[model samples]
Target chain A: MSRRSFLRGCAAFGGVTALAASLAPLRELGDYTNTEQFLQKYYKELTPSDMTKVITRIEGEVERQYGIRPHVRDLKPMDGVEFVYALNLTRCIGCRKCVHACVKENNQSRSPEIQYIRVLKMPHGSMDVEKGNHNYDSKQVPEKGFFYMPIQCQQCKNPPCVKVCPVNATWQEKDGITVIDYDWCIGCRYCEAACPYWARRFNFTKPQIPKDKINPDMSYLGNRPRKQGVMEKCHFCIQRTRVGKYPACLEACPVGARKFGNILDPNSEVSYILREKRVFIQLKEEMGTSPRFFYYFDK
Target chain B: MAKLDPSAQKKSDHTANYWLGGLTAVFFSLTIFFAFNSKPHVAAQPEIPLVDKKFLDTSPWRQTYADLVKAKEDLSDYDCYACHDKAKPPRIRYDTNQKIIIPKEHANIEMSHGTHERNNICYNCHNEQNLNTLQVRDGNVVKFDNIPQLCGSCHGPTLRDWEAGAHGRTSGYWDRQLGDINRLSCANCHNPHAPDIPTREAAPGPHYLHEASSHEPSKSHR
Candidate 1:
């Protein structure tokens, strides 16, 4: 071969080697995306043994990372139970105890803090949520002309978030709770956009919870530690409620403003509220989500 | 020769038909007898009784409140019987204008439930005869847990609402069959003397990614 042609070939070979070296990091990024995670079946599609394997794997991962053994369970919904929540506006003293209780119960990320309940301080005479300030920093609450209204996942019968999911990760349970499979989620943010109440929260980073604060009693579909880039919302405290316990938020409200019960049971507190009180739901006219959460004023 | 035996064959066929008829009759008789003799099944009783009379009856509102308070933590520290054992405490002497004479012991208590112009006496709700118990409008004594009855005498509508799980807080199981349920008493959230819950500092607000951007409009307008 000619000397000039040899020189040109060497230059081309050097350029190709440099380009391949720079692209090596992109290939390493693919290593972080586990093939096992990608190939994992949907939550409902998993067989009993497959579910056990997934649960065990999750438990191991959590134990390794957080140095705490999480009791991950896959609790199924009970029959003849439809949960409903009611808030007495007159009784809510604007104390946000419910918010922190929910965070603690749900194993929410403590650093980039995530809270399910958002209590809005609205003007006393108005019912508009837009005018409501969730960031009120006043010294004393029930501030002269203000009333508190807490907003959380309504667990709608016809959830808009479930409808917008590209991957069928989010679905409504038999007991009227909408749940998201963190593993199955694609981080599309479609559910976040579709939710009218702003109930959904996107995990921007891997949840960083202290070892001691991690709620060991977690359900696979509920308060289990979530991966980065997934959507999560309130699942009606499924870890507790599925086992016939009250939601953490209801137990935390000092003023006794919150009421939760099975709507199907005639003797349940929620049934009494719905039957007797002039109960009204938030954003009723807006998309007809038929939310189970209700707000009412008592005389 | 074949024609001679035809009558005999017919006789045999008639005998077979008679036997079949008798068997059908016996079958029908047995069916009729069994159908009439069988007894109807009764429904099994529910594991937990459905009717909770406390939730249903509203006549003696004090009883309902007592049942609710039973599930809650008792106020062991606030023992009224510590001072009053048997005899009723002496009444606080009042002036002609109905101004209360503050006793040395009760000097700390400032009664301000009703407006200043109205002559609101502590004895109106307190049992003068028994200092440990509270008094209803009809002068009946009620336990501290049943203080709702005293409050309800004036606030009838609120009592009704509280009974129906519309006014107060309810915690625990939605299905009371599964676990215990608790409904807060009137005194649990409100001070009976003042009745007005004071305002207090609320919990911290949401810290979101775009919180700064969202608050700009409200700040500029304000």
Candidate 2:
């Protein structure tokens, strides 16, 4: 054979080999081998009856897997309400109570370490996020001159993550929380890359949640068990918050540093923070994400 | 159509049959190989223990007014009239350092509120005439449930922030129309005597998958 023909043959062989190798991981997906899930309709397309069936299927699957019958439902956003968060930098002591509280409440994989909130231990003067350390070892909190800044999904008005999704799996809800449909997500990781705050967590392997530790209260778009290929971020505890309850993080905070409420309500705590307090930080405001989460100082 | 070439035709047909038979044998063998040999992969669950319950608890340890009201039995500790006289006013005592010595009977009360030692007096908050009632700086008597009014007289900014839901913890519904709201009073979280918050044990840091499995045991959170 001529040189050009030999090269073409090699290229074809290499392409076939690469394609075969890419599909090898699919063999390990035994638990998700159900044909029923593959045939299920999209989130919005599912009618009320369809939703009930889907919820039942989910409940059955979770009960079979974890031996706990979880209460799963799709919580729709309430009308005339826009959620916003105000974190007091002055009062925060870097206790990390919110982090673990979120984990317990959200049913995040405990072993593979999926956490929604990350409190940055920053030195007194610096405002740059890069300077903050996440792995600070200390006996107690509010140590000396150091201040804490807890970061989570900002639930931005204009989210870059949503813009980059190849599949329309993740979107901002009416109540200003961005949610992900685990069933529909194709796991491109484009949203993970697009997030400025490093909020999105991709499951590199199958998530390993302990049976007893799993929060049985789960919502379709919130703390529901995400598969290996999907992405998950903070949904402001949709399971609790949608039913007119405070997020676990807010309830857990010992210092009362974290504040959350409807921005539409003029009397809300978050509104009061924005109006009266010197609420200055939006965290990457220059990125134009228009995050609903705000940080403020006492002085 | 060519009947004279039957023997040649038969030989060619036999060769084609052999080829077809070999292909069919190979296909069946491959199917058997896959069906018998390829066990469906199941991911092994990692054996990572949950963190201690000390870290998982998120609720505030302090008692709210509603909680106090609900537990009527726990209210005996706050009953001042049970021990003190109701008719006579408690006499105010000041030492040379302008600090009132905490009486032996009130050993649980730690009266170090301000740097100036001026707010340590019992009458600063407590009603002198009626020990059951608490008084503000304005000499107005306030109930135990309305302790925020008395705290507001001294901590004006903090009280304002608390009223606006900016400074303290508020549980229950953010939407007032839907559910019951629980706004914690001043005494719920802070001790009126020593207003400064103590540094307690913090929760454990994140345990990454690849990192060392066990975390150093931290102190229990109160």
Candidate 3:
């Protein structure tokens, strides 16, 4: 071909390629086919139309991935079923049943480092909090003056994790439960580090769950398989508890050490427990976490 | 300048043109190489085949999630570490990694279980499933794996504390609402080797050396 004609042909080819490249973002925005690659923004940034589209996409993705359709709640919290939990330190057997339940129930990655609960084992007769060790070892109960205190997300009424999230990735609902928008979280780890109880865990990698083993019973907000590099914490099993029933840890504790009920109802079991027990929360003074989880030693 | 023969003039012109073309070509080639190398390439890798033979032959396993049915069986067996090659099996990490040493004759039965035997393993209470999932019974889907039901599966009274939010850590951002959200396995906390808490060397002890007061009004000093 002549040199001038060849140059023109080359220009045409380059132009077409550039057009395709430029249109890529628009194509994704119109229809989020590549949900995995298309990272979502915080709830505050989403418009009503954007939210509708995003929610539709999320529901579709959940069905595609898990084979089960979850009822994603768009409505606000109900008034009466205010979820709550309590722990009896005296009755605790130091068995880590609760921690394991959390891993499986929350669809957590199978890593020891990501455990939600850290049972601080302190020597008997010692009031020093600094000396307590979370790394306890025992085959049976009572490692010679050591008692178990399982620590997890306190579901604080005034949650610090919600306050520190830069993107507002996490917040408390009307019922005093802290919730996280996993897609919006930037994996900053600020919330993780800020939690005095070390309750919040970050998905350092795409959570590893055996496909066949994937828990079909997952809520959009809780226990769904999470993507890599986002912060997550206990949601008090909103999918389950909001409907009624009990928590996994409460069911698993061999020593009758856990309790749960509605705090809103003065006649509920939790209200009674709080009224009768001399209870205390973890790190109450420094942070004012105002946690709903309370602990009392019966002895 | 003297008039030259046609053949000689033609040969001189060809040599000059050849040199110019060669220089231009060299410059363009270098420019193209650098420009192409600077841009990033975003491409997806091929997926792993489902068959076992293919998996075994593959040099590096691609990111394929495990089969769900097989995974349920694996969960029952507690063999999570087998496929995840990165996992180091839970070992006793302190004091030569042997059986934990608790000082004998210490008061507190909860701490002194050297003789009293405990029956439950990791799964008895933590179980094959976690509490957050939906349970369908008799054609009805029941949400919330009540702590009482699971704890009552093993320990009856513990369910009471879980509901009251008084048995576990009360400070983190996890539990307290619904009680069903708490992690279940006993291994999540209370490491099986060292039961005693770690002590800080930097901080002073709670008690300190005291000196007698000389200015006491009607006491021993007076």
Cα-based lDDT at residue B27, candidate 1: 49
**Model 2 scores what on Cα lDDT?**
0.82
Superior by DockQ: candidate 1 or candidate 3: 1
User: Which residue window of length 10 is worst by lDDT in model 3 chain B?
Assistant: B200-209
Which residue ranges in model 2 land beyond 4 Å of their true spot? A1-28, B1-47, B64-66, B74-76, B79-99, B116-118, B212-222
Kindly report which residue pairs in candidate 1 clash with one another: A141-B200
Minimum summed lDDT over a 10-residue window in model 1 chain A is located at: A24-33
Candidate 1: which stretches are off by over 4 Å? A1-35, B1-88, B93-101, B108-110, B114-119, B214-222
> What DockQ class does candidate 2 belong to?
acceptable
Superposed model 3: Cα runs more than 4 Å off: A1-56, A66-75, A111-113, A127-129, B1-222
Model 3 Cα shift for residue A161 (angstroms) = 1.6
On DockQ, the candidate that comes out on top is 2
Winner by lDDT between candidate 3 and candidate 2? 2
Alpha carbon RMSD to native, model 3 = 19.1
Report the error of model 3 at residue A134, Å: 3.1
Each model's lDDT: 0.75, 0.82, 0.55
What does candidate 1's lDDT look like per residue over B93-127, in tens digits? 88797877777766666555767735357778888
